[model samples]
Target: MTTENKGIVQRALAGLIETGDVNTLASFLSDDFLHHRSDATTSTKAEWLAAVHAALGPTAGMQVEILHLLADTDHVVVHSRRRLPDAGPEIVVVDVLRVADGLIAEVWEIIEPVAQTAVNAAWWEPARL
Candidate 1:
């Protein structure tokens, strides 16, 4: 079930990136899906879809590179890097999705802009014990 849930999220994200079709993305969501943003705002399925379309439509030229996927029985967390069309600094986005009955029922997302300065250890380096 955990693996299945992860796959469901992976496929949904891939579909959105590949086709840029809101309907395709909609197919993976539950009818009563809700999206909770980092800003403390929540959006319904329809509202989220509309937002996605307006922000990341085909011509937006946004690219998403998934960095990590972690899942349990009913939740999947995806950490990714997003590059917008303007070629500005990359953004890191983490979405935690709750899956029920093979569809995504809810999502909580956080987004942060990549820092230009060296603040800490390199992201690619393995943690030291």
Candidate 2:
């Protein structure tokens, strides 16, 4: 079911980088998985993990909210929000990923810092996912 596949992607986004979970996260992605970021930077799965580890430290914790998650046979779009420890700013991210054989093969993501006080967290939200 597409929704079930979407659930997998959602869980990956939430728990991928946490302690004792990176390997499980890897299993959800293809070896050639690529991530395209809003900053115009791109990275492979390993590179991404290394980058996050560097930025947030080896043992960073985060809180995630799956605001929206939508999927089809080949792709899923997740609008998720996260707040990290050693806190910088609240971030709202929209990740559009292509899934193949039940694994994420490619992703295009946009991340924005939520204002201290804002009416809507994201740029915009679809009526329904």
Candidate 3:
């Protein structure tokens, strides 16, 4: 069975950034899912997929390194680092998700550019534990 926790979101996001496979990613999101990013002015899933595809079109690969994950009655928080094959690595994003019926329905995100105060680590490290 598919896991119904934040891992599902992370895996979906990973597939999007790494492979630009919006179809695979879309299956994991609710029809009303909210999407946010570092530079987003809108939150539509189509826009989100478009942006991911645009970025991956030039970059060779992408990766999301989740730093933290917190869950409650209806939500999950994922702090992550997004890396590009050409740009190297750094801590980049923190995402908050509201889930319903095992699907992500809402999201709020914070994106930080590479900074001295941030630390880069494995995505599955603390986020899974």
- The digit string of per-residue lDDT tens for model 2 on 23-66 reads 66777889899989877899989997676555444466666677
Per-candidate local distance difference test: 0.89, 0.76, 0.69
RMSD of each predicted structure: 4.7, 5.7, 8.0
How does model 3 fare in lDDT?
Answer: 0.69
| lDDT at position 13, candidate 1 | 87
User: Which residue pairs come into collision in candidate 1?
Assistant: none
As for candidate 3, its clashing pairs are 66-123
lDDT of 1 by residue, 104-124 (tens): 999999888887424433555
* lDDT for predicted candidate 2 compared with the true structure: 0.76
TM-score of each: 0.86, 0.74, 0.66
Q: Single out the weakest 10-residue window by summed lDDT for candidate 1.
A: 116-125
What TM-score number comes out for model 1?
0.86
For model 1, the local distance difference test gives: 0.89
Model 3: per-residue Cα lDDT at residue 107: 79
